[model samples]
Target: MQKNSGKSVLLLFILLIVSTLSAGCTDNSSTSQTIQTSEETSTRTLTDALGRTVEIPESVDYVICSGVGSLRYLTYLEAQDKIIGVERSETTNSASNAKPYSLANPQFSTDYPVFGETRGMDDPEKILSLDPLPEVIIKTYSATGFDPVELQEKTGIPVVIVNTGDLADNKEDLYESLRIIGEVVGKEERAEEVISFFDENIADLKERIADIPEEDKPTCYVGGIGRAGGPQGFQSTEPTYPPFLFTNAINVAYGDMDINVADVSKEKIIEWDPEIIFLDLNTIECGEDRSGLRLLQNDESYRQLQAVQSGNVYGVLPFNQYATNFGSVLADSYFAGKTLYPDKFEDVDLENKTIEIYTFLVCKGDEELGREIYNTMINVYGTPAFAKLDI
Candidate 1:
């Protein structure tokens, strides 16, 4: 029995030594293979939707954005270094109010350098001629107003398309678009993280407001422009587009009107008599700096409306919020929600929202961007009720 025990101990000792040696050899082999693969891994090249087969650095370095919506998504990815240029019109001095605030960090537009404005997308010669060509050009589907394939042939730069425009009906399609941007920017983890955050927060918001009585839901009107000459002050009958429909308020316009937008008379608005009126701030007055309420007050015909009397006129910045584009609409939704339900959303800080939006949608830093966004909001909507509550 003693002899058998000694033999078993020796066998175990030998097996332990063998295992250690095997592990050491495996580690060395893996290290060698990794080094070899790194040397052999060439930069990948692919043909984007634009039909241009462009080569990209194994590490994507620069991205040039052409439209607002695509820029917002790229900023959210935290892939700012990838941005090389942007359309000049995005930086128009007269149209500084155009950038959407809610879903963007200020850095996206203010910090990043602009190449030139995209006056017309069909002129590929202009985009291609810009100094320091970009590795990727992110564009919106409808805004670019050009066939992507043709553009690619002219510029020889790959184009990535992100549908930031809420043209998609539901949230699932929206997330899918995020995933696509993630794949393009090589930030899949960040994309998923952002998508998850949006889902969780939105779900929480729905739950928080779900138990509230329907009777308590605020009656709101949303429209593209403010008409002061109407019998009622400002009409609250805008269609449920990107931002306004996502808010906590009930859309009075959608509920009561069969608006074809072809021939909406001023008298029709007086019939609705909305409690709240939200208008496109940028497009109002044929071009003027005034709130929707002010417009109603200035016009002699609108003295009878409840909205103007109650001071419930809300202004939506058209350059950013009303634009049927990517980040613009998302920002519009965030701002619209907060504006509609200030009491319930008081805790939902815009700063944090701005940062998250910049990270998730704009993919950029959250610096001066917040201030710029706030400024745009103030210009469009007037200072929040809280700002003047002390007075």
Candidate 2:
């Protein structure tokens, strides 16, 4: 009986030891799993518009956009809520500040902080000083002198490069840039919507004008197109202007020029002698000194042109402020179509069409807000004095 009792005691002791060891192993395994989960949730990799593979946070909550159109693209994605800072140009209030993105996002100027110089200059000090250090910095390809890899290394933040295409020619770059931004911001669906909206509008415009014969297309010239604030007279023009291109109008400014906006001699203007003239209202808004409309109105040389004498001259909203106001570009195209080929665009309503384009792009489809923006562009502020002509 004594031997049997001792055997039972030994067996119980061994069982207790085994139970403790199992518990310890379970705790260690649980700790390892927790550490792995934390690492997985910490960071993710993405390819930016510049094709640089960057590791960003798994969830990007705060950001700063540099360059001319970085913030504008963000606005299109409806991720403006993530922006922690803006460029200096966004803070300034002006009638000429016709960027629909800015008009749609009023809080950017009133609430958010401005960082560094305009057009995406490197101000690492200011960026670091932000209250909540931005997790990422977005920049446009146009932001010169700032290298993305160097900037990322200096700030220890992921820098994503984006391209803001001219919208006239390099539209594919713009679409790709939007997709990259959507991936980074986790708004892929909204980005697709924006791209679709632009594509549909452009396609519709083209389809409407496609059947028109080349000989029937009106010869057109757009002048006083603003570029980096300078001496803009009647000769400043966009060679590949969006309005003329989309409407299928003949742009007499078209030539083998290396730049979009360039100066043409008054003699060249008289030589081409386009039937219709669209004055960019920006030159007049810049004040009397830079007013190309004023030159066209007062100059006897301009009076000799057929478009001027026959009252075919019209005013178009400035679409080139701080980059391109894409909404204005589309709106200008419709207006140009209506004016140049009135019978073709007879079914189109300018006010309703402008509202539709603006609603799709900005202000969340608010027709009233669309009208306000449109009025600011064509009627209220930027309209040239000569636009009152009886054409």
Candidate 3:
């Protein structure tokens, strides 16, 4: 009976040992699975602000700017090296910054040579004719009928829609747009630099104007005086346009002024009779040198206005830097301060400020030219318009 009991105990011990080995193997297998899951999640792809799911590529090299001015930011960030192609307009001699650079250095725009204008984003056939595919397409939009989603569906390439509404409203949108583009193009650091420069300059301009009293703030007006392509000179009196919004100054014609931009009649302008006139260089008078602004200043009907007498009128030419020209917001602010208390900003230097904005937007740093554009007009229209409008 004792020998049989001892044998049973030894059998029980062997069974226990086998059970322990099996449990250990199961635990190790589970740990291995958890580690594999973590690795996969780390590399997982995500969607961007434009609502497109983009996988972070091992490296992003080739790029194409789908809409106008998209390439300007890319070039500003120094990421032009990664661009494979750009719209024909972007490569044109008329495009200012990009054109001169592209001409001097063939390599400037030739990384990938794309032919055709910037207006054909929806033309898949034209895009396809380019043959080689771009990994990404960046575009801008307003109320236009061309749907970005449809374009994406037509072409296998992913389309990222950038909302340009902010260009007409606030500064936050500008920074946000930059960050989104940077992420798409893998130029995050460069984007941050551009944003920082914009923020710092804006802050400085505000600081200089803070001491002025609210009652004394200069009343201001911002708009484009001449249309470049129109058979007759064009007046962009529309309150919703870029020149008005980016300037951040009060538009005399915006709220109760009853001005019609589409009709673009000088009769409409005479009724508004804004104290401070801001001219867009592309206006009908573009090639006429200061002719557009001069016409408005010398027009017999406008001679009685305080602005024409005091020299408060100014003109800003549209280009990559001023093309979007958020700096005009600061220009508006500085001009307002000077009008309110000429003594305070006497040393503030509007000319220098103009240069700073141009420099920030493009490497050309045309400070003198910026001052020249403003002075040529401001001298003609006097300061009363700038003074009468509360900025």
Candidate 4:
């Protein structure tokens, strides 16, 4: 019985060793499965501005903006650091003050790599060659340039489309765009704050002049409005100009035109002879012969207008530098409110308000930085960019 007990102990040790070997083999297979599952779980889906459901990385740290105002949105989010590259137009020396976002972050033109030409015309080759390759492409305007879907297929990166809805009637759409972008870059809170800021400002602008009698409202007109190509002449204007809407000032061009924007006849201007004439500073870019400022100051027809005679003509920042400079739009609204209704906005300081709007929107609450950008803007466009015209 003692001999059999020793043999039993040896057999039990051998069986234990065999079981350990089998468990080790099972663990190796399980590890491979876990790595495979990890790869599969690395991505999640997103619904973009176009209502297209797209699959994007669960953790996105780098991206490229492919459309007009796309980089502007990034600046608004204060997430411009996440941008791996940008469009070529943004880096150009021409029209330096055209896009305030570009001016606010000069690094966008110099430090980051170039992705493609302006207006979403992406070059997939350039995109793929970027160091530390981007994880996604965010686009705003799609009417022209590379289609987001095709660009995604060519570059092998998720392309997320967003909208920079017009600042006026479609403003809610713009808010949704901001929120969508915020979600992608982990700036959800910032996006909501921006929307709230716009809402609060709009409400305040409206309330300040709400009690003013309609008969007391002065007739207003805006000209030299910039468009897709470049600066237009004094005759060019927007009927639904956002600044006009914000200040509740009556725009003579608002209901007279068949389209949202067009060049009104000089004869019509002589007829309406708006009590207040607001010229877009971009008109200075129209060259000596074509400049809106040149026309207002030199042209016999424009000089004869009542606003010009009374020195009611004022200079407002251009909001349409590359499809609506959102920050500039807000800034212009404040100036318009103050100029048209001094009594209502007597407490408002133009310089301080400009700094506040630029800081909150582009400088991320850095008051000093906002002040610097404002100074740079006026320097480029001249002091008349946001004040009473010498005319």
Candidate 5:
């Protein structure tokens, strides 16, 4: 009996040893799986306008901007140096007035090679051929050409889509886009700075005119707004134009219209007969005979308008080119404010303000370059811009 018990005990000890070794192996296998998972998955990602969760490097130093306004945003962040190449449209613009972002940084034309056709046709092969091979492609308007996912798969590079939100309705989208670009370019501070600048200035502007009665506000109209197909004469107008919104100017075309834009008949404009009219100089692109300015100069109906006859008409910079010229938008607001309520904005110098916005946004606070771009804008947008139209 004593011998049988000893054998049973020895067998039990053997079974316990096997069970302990199996448990050790199981623990090691689990540890190995955890390590593999850690290697394969990463947490660094950003959600873009398309609602795409895109994985990004911890620090991105090389990038390509695709679609409209992408490059403009990059310029705002002062990250143009990170660009691999530029779009053909940017280089091919034959208009007298250069796009503001390009105007601020002329090197975009001469220094970088053309990446692909403009308006969303990013060529993956061409992108891959660029020196230092862009690590990421930042895009806006993904629906236009190559799909962001397709572009990523073709080039074996990551693509992030963004949105160019307008000042009126989708301002939050605009701010988010800036934040994404800022994070990608490691310029988060700059992104906030730009956002804060907009917020603070917008408040200051609205505050300045807050006390004035709506009935006392000057009746105004803005025309010659640019569209997808280029300049669209005086008929192109925005009811909720930012400049008008900021100063509480009574837009003759406001009340019922498209949320983003609208058109007005010549007869309707005659009916409104706004006390003041501000012409977006983008119409200059359509040539003097066809542009909004020409219509105002030649049309007897427009000539008879009180605002034009009284010389209360003025030229404001174009706020949209590639995508909203943000600096130009704010600049136009000040000009609009100064035009309507000279006493309220009397302390504000129009020329100095434009330069200030340009310097901070594109020139990286370089006042000399800001003034240079300001002069270029004036040269193209005549009536010496930011002043009374000699009409």
Candidate 6:
């Protein structure tokens, strides 16, 4: 009887030991599987706009934009929600906020932190010091003097390069940049929507003006092109101005200089004597009394020009604000077409057109915003000055 009882006790002890070993193995296997899954899901490799291979977070929720137009591109992609910081210029300059992107994303003005010195001038130390450090950094190809690879090495963070090209002539580059940004933020569909919008608008504009004879197109000149906050005088102009190019207007300033934005002599402007003149509203916004309109209103040489004498001088919304407000560019094209050839755009509703553009670009269709933009471009203190003969 004692031996049988001892045998039963030994059998129970062996069963308990087996049970303990099985539980330990199960727990360890679960831990190993969890670790492996985490490792697999944490990161992914992608080719950026510059074609550089980078391993970025699989779920990117935080990023920093570095360069002149990088933030603007991100805004277009509707990924501003992921932006953790901005350049100091974005916070300091109230005028910069006048851009449609800024209007749409007010959080940039109120809540986000400022890290870099300014657009295109990144400070690595400041970037590293950001609390809850960003997951990735996206910079314009020509943004900073520092090497992007070096930056990645120093910070141990993936750096992606995007090219924010001249939107007026480099639509391909813009589309590529948008796609790259979308890929990073997982907004590929949104990027395609933006590209489609651009494509449709440009194609429609081309179709509308395709049959207009070149000789019938009015000779046009744009002045008061702003640079670094100060307005250029009457002679300052863009040779490849998008508004002029897209609307099929004869840009008298085209090929006048080798540079994109150049200042020509007043005599040279008079020599060209374009039939229509577009004044950039930036000078008036600057309040520095350096506007082309101020010169046209004050100077006899400008007043004697045929376009001004004929009341063909028109106001165009500032396009260069915070690196080319693309909405403003398309809007300016419509207004230019209307002013140059009223009969061509007679059926077009300017207010509705502006709202449509703002809606697509900034995702805002607020009537008040559209009205403000319209007023800023066409009216001076409630007086309609677009194409008006008298200054």
Give the alpha carbon lDDT tens digit for every residue of 1-391 in model 3: 9999999999999989999999999999999999988764543244555666655443456566665446655665556666656666554443233222232235544455563355544466555555456666666652343466776678666666555323445556667767777877777887898788766755665566556565554445444433223322335544644434332345656665455654455666666666666554444333343345546655676555556666766544432221354444445556555654567667877667655654555444455544444443333223222233211
Relative to the unseen true structure, what is the C-alpha lDDT of residue 72 in candidate 5, on a scale of 0 to 100? 92
**Candidate order by decreasing lDDT:** 5, 4, 2, 6, 1, 3
Better of 3 and 5 by lDDT: 5
Q: Write the per-residue lDDT of candidate 2 for residues 171-242, one digit (tens) a residue.
A: 988998889889888989998999998888888788788899999988998888877663356788988898
User: What TM-score number comes out for model 1?
Assistant: 0.66
Stronger candidate by TM-score (5 vs 6) = 6
Best model number under TM-score: 4
| Residue-wise C-alpha lDDT for candidate 6, range 10-111, written one tens digit per residue | 999999999999999999999999999997678988887767898998888899988777888888887888888888766753553467677666677678
Candidate 4, run of 10 with poorest lDDT = 255-264
Which run of 10 residues does model 2 get worst, by summed lDDT? Answer: 382-391
Candidate number of the best lDDT = 5
Q: What TM-score would each prediction reach against the true structure?
A: 0.66, 0.87, 0.65, 0.91, 0.87, 0.88
Residue pair clashes in candidate 5: none
**Model 5: per-residue lDDT, tens digit, 253-333?**
888453346467888889889899999888877887868888988999999999998998899888668667888899999
lDDT of model 6 at position 304: 89
lDDT of each: 0.55, 0.80, 0.53, 0.85, 0.86, 0.77
Better of 1 and 3 by lDDT: 1
State the lDDT at 2 in candidate 5: 100
Instruction: Kindly give the number of clashing pairs for every candidate.
Output: 24, 0, 27, 0, 0, 1
